[model samples]
Target: MTTESSDARPLPTLTRRSGDDLRCSIARTLQVLGDRWTILIVREGFRGHTRFSDFRRVLGIPTDILTSRLSSLVEAGVLERRGYREPGARERFDYHLTAAGDALLPVLGALAEWGNEYRPSGHGPSRLYQHAETGEATSIAFVTAAGAVVPLTDIAIVPGPGENDPGVGPTHPLAAHH
Candidate 1:
């Protein structure tokens, strides 16, 4: 099913105030990327589009809103801005997703897959990815080399003393990150 703009994933709703510990890695990551348009911008960047006008045209996003989102993404190091110029035209800005942003593609793909499965749809997915080698419709799943599907599992932490706990390292990979 093709998700419409109105399809029911609501905007992220986390808030932090001064002196609050938004220190968890997941929370910190969300703080930078939790904005509605950030991932979409990364998506487009991966598609080889760089210029402001290209993004504006493809996304149909408002210019100011796009500007703000782009700015935020750049500030967060998810994107890099570079200048380009055309003959007889003004210098223009372009954006490209950084490695950190590209790393989120799998996460986005997973979310898209979930929405397709659970959401009601008279038709099946609007589009399907095909396996190039076999020419069969394909989707991504977490599986072992032996083809065993893996279920999500809780990750346990072994902490040492330092910052996270008394003897923990200065930064816990699981804590306060983006």
Candidate 2:
């Protein structure tokens, strides 16, 4: 199920199951932000939580668990640490989302959409993303290269030049529905 890549150098002969873990982008993304608490912490970041106490209080998360998740987020380049102190206080670190972390907005939006759509708990949207200028609620969607928004059935799975196995992605457990 290999495809030909037109690159001068060969890409890694890898899959999601690769030992070095450089294969599937999704797998690597999960490795960085795989856990529930980790994702929640990232969500809190998007919600403007920077201080450790803010996350702990808002999420009702323990100090040690919040600390570990913040460390992991920083290590994964999803968040950056900044030192802050009051005039008479000792310095402490605050976590802010890096560019990589900012890129996760859509992922979180998609997850929120899914929860709102399928797992409704009789509540409305927890929060809404609004256009800063227009104040219109924003939503995530699949857009084509032609700039057309299309439905899932319109999308297709094909081998990319670097794809090691066409069978792997299309039939993957997560993507199987789509």
Candidate 3:
């Protein structure tokens, strides 16, 4: 099935299998952070928990799983591993968030906000997002290039430049629209 977009172009109907051949940013991102444990490790990184033992203790994650997740994050450029050693002790590594990882703050905030609203625990929010300098509350939204915050109802998803790549040819539905 397909739907006619505003420009009278037919939009591709996506299914679980459709993403397998598509150049999708969300799909690529999920390859790095799809699991609960991986995301929680990122949360720990944001909270300044860098040591392996600190992550294990705080999240109660199994040693093998934590090791795998941390290794994957490092390989994906989400975390940077640096060597640190105390005197007379064996060298160890601490994980720090790279720019790519630090940029996930807004994604984390959006996830938290959605959870608080739709999956409430019946008590209250355990945490809130606020400005560091002004202490003002903040929330994420779809902002236009002109700095206008558009309502969710007004939002639309259209083909980006990636979908319109000339090399991809008309074999891809959206590529034909370009």
Per-candidate local distance difference test: 0.67, 0.77, 0.80
Best by lDDT: 3
How would you encode candidate 2's per-residue C-alpha lDDT over 35-61 as one tens digit per residue?
A: 889999999999999999899999998
Q: Estimate TM-scores for all models.
A: 0.65, 0.80, 0.80
lDDT of 2: 0.77
State the lDDT of candidate 1 residue by residue for 65-135, as single tens digits.
99988987777767889998889998888998776666676667676688798884768765455676988
* Each candidate structure's count of clashing pairs: 10, 0, 0
| Candidate with more favorable, higher lDDT: 1 or 2 | 2
Sort order, lDDT high to low: 3, 2, 1
**lDDT of candidate 1?**
0.67
Output the lDDT of residue 158, model 3. 61
